[model samples]
Target: MIAVCQFGGSNCDRDAVLALRHLGFEAERVWHADGLPAEADGVVLPGGFSYGDYLRAGAMAARAPILREVCDAAERGVPVLGICNGAQVGTETGLVPGAFTTNASARFRCEHVHLRVENAETPWTAGFEPGEVLTLPIAHGEGRFEIAEDTLADLDDDRVLFRYCNEAGAVTDAANPNGSVDGVAGLLGEHEHTAVLMPHPERATLPDLGGTDGRTILRGFASEAEG
Candidate 1:
């Protein structure tokens, strides 16, 4: 079973469960206070404005009681994927590096954007080849990734899972929707089993939504866990 954590303002909890189910995974929303189920084989921190975005987008949810169990699960090598606001929580809890901050435009951005798969080596991105361009939608006001210049330089290429790019897979400033440093869209955690990103993979999983590129990313959980 996969647990989709539901926080106070987690609007995407059900969407995540539905998306995972559509992909043939057993998943359900687990309220933040209820903690994780013992049978949970994977975890997804779905997108949304947790705690009304108080103090910060994901600050409150990152400190929630259930997060302790989530952290423990990640340490045990359980596949964990954090999207959008969840990405912020991941960074807040130190599950992933860097921070998602205010966009350069200082406005909420909601649109489909192209992403270049920077590394296909990690479990979260193994479905695609490096340099593949995927179309994914990003909706956020604080989705710009911020990291120290030196630290960013030290991250292995494999650690940078995805980067905003043009349809041709070129990383250009005009293609960067959020002005994230180096166009980073997603990153791997301390281990390949964990990952965080600002894009809404669940939203892009259904073909009816006009894109199925995200299915590959979510499929990673099933593939990795079953392996």
Candidate 2:
């Protein structure tokens, strides 16, 4: 089973579970305090205003008691996928690199944006071809990815899961929705099994709710379940 964690303000936990179940996977919303189940083969930190964005988007949730268990699971090779607010939590918890701060516009962005698959080898992007373009929505005010130039330069290209891009798959500032550094929209941790992205794949998982361009990302859980 896949465990979709629910923080105090995690409105997306149910959406994540529903989307995963739509794809034929067993998913449940495990409350933050309730703890993750031993049967959970995968974990999801879905988008939301966790702790009402206290301190920062995900700072509070990062320090939650259950996060420790999540980290332990990740270290043990369990797959962990973080989205939007969860992406912020992932960075705060050191699951991935870089920081998600205010957008370049300093305002919330909510609309469809294009993304380029940067690393097709990762489980998160294995369904798409290299440089494939996907349309996903962004709804966040603090989605910019801030990283030191030196640190950004050292990031392995293979670890970059996705980058904002034009419809033709060109990485350009014009196509960047949140002004994330290097147009990064998603990134993998040391292992492909761990990753975070600011886009809400759950929102796009339903056939009629939004475009299904994100089903492949969520499908990663099924792969882990089989293992």
Candidate 3:
């Protein structure tokens, strides 16, 4: 069973559940306070407005009781996927590093962005071709990725995924929607299991909805969890 964590202010839990179901996985929403379900095979931290975006986007939500459980599970190599605010929580919990701060523009922006797969080896991006152009929606103000140069080097060494320009496959400000250093939009954990991405894959799971680009990303996770 795949575990989908639901927390106060987490608005995308249902969308995540639906996506997982569409991919034919058994997924359950484990409440923020409840310990992670014992039967979970993997976990997901869906996008949302956790804690009313108080104390910084995911700061308060990271301290939730169940997050500790999620952290523990991740240490044991259970896969975790954090999207948008969920990505923020992962950073706060230290399951993933870095923080989301106000966008360079200083306001929320919503639009479709083009992304190139920089690391296709990650479970989530396994089905996507290296350098593939994928269109996905991004809505956030504090999404820039801040990390030390050494840490960025380490991520590259470990194959942590990142988003690059669809045209040149370069990490630059133009391709970076939120001023994230090096155009970092996603991360694959050191173990290469957990992944956090700012773009909304759940929102683009259907072709009729103007996309099927997410099918590979979501399907890759569900397939690996079952295996």
Top-scoring candidate (lDDT): 1
Q: For residue 206, give model 1's deviation from the true position in Å.
A: 1.5
**Model 2 per-residue lDDT tens digits across residues 138-204:** 8899999988899888988888888999999999999998789999999988778999999888889
For each candidate, the alpha-carbon lDDT, in order, equals 0.91, 0.89, 0.82
lDDT of 3: 0.82
Q: Indicate the worst ten consecutive residues by lDDT in candidate 2.
A: 218-227
Query: Which window of 10 residues has the lowest lDDT sum in candidate 3?
Result: 157-166
Every candidate's CA RMSD? 0.9, 1.0, 1.6
Model 1 residue 153 lDDT score: 83
Question: What are the models' TM-scores?
Answer: 0.98, 0.97, 0.94
Q: Sorted on lDDT, highest at the top, how do the candidates line up?
A: 1, 2, 3
TM-score for candidate 3: 0.94
- Name the runs in model 3 displaced over 4 angstroms: 164-170
Q: Model 1, which residues run further than 4 Å from truth?
A: none
On the 0 to 100 scale, the lDDT of residue 59 in model 3 is 87
- Determine the C-alpha RMSD for candidate 2 after optimal superposition of all C-alphas: 1.0
Put down candidate 3 lDDT per residue, 14-91, tens digits, no spaces: 988888888788888888787798888788898989999898888888899888888888888788888999999888
Model 3, position 10, has a per-residue lDDT of: 92
What is residue 127's positional error in candidate 2, in angstroms? 0.6
Error of 3 at 25 (Å): 1.5
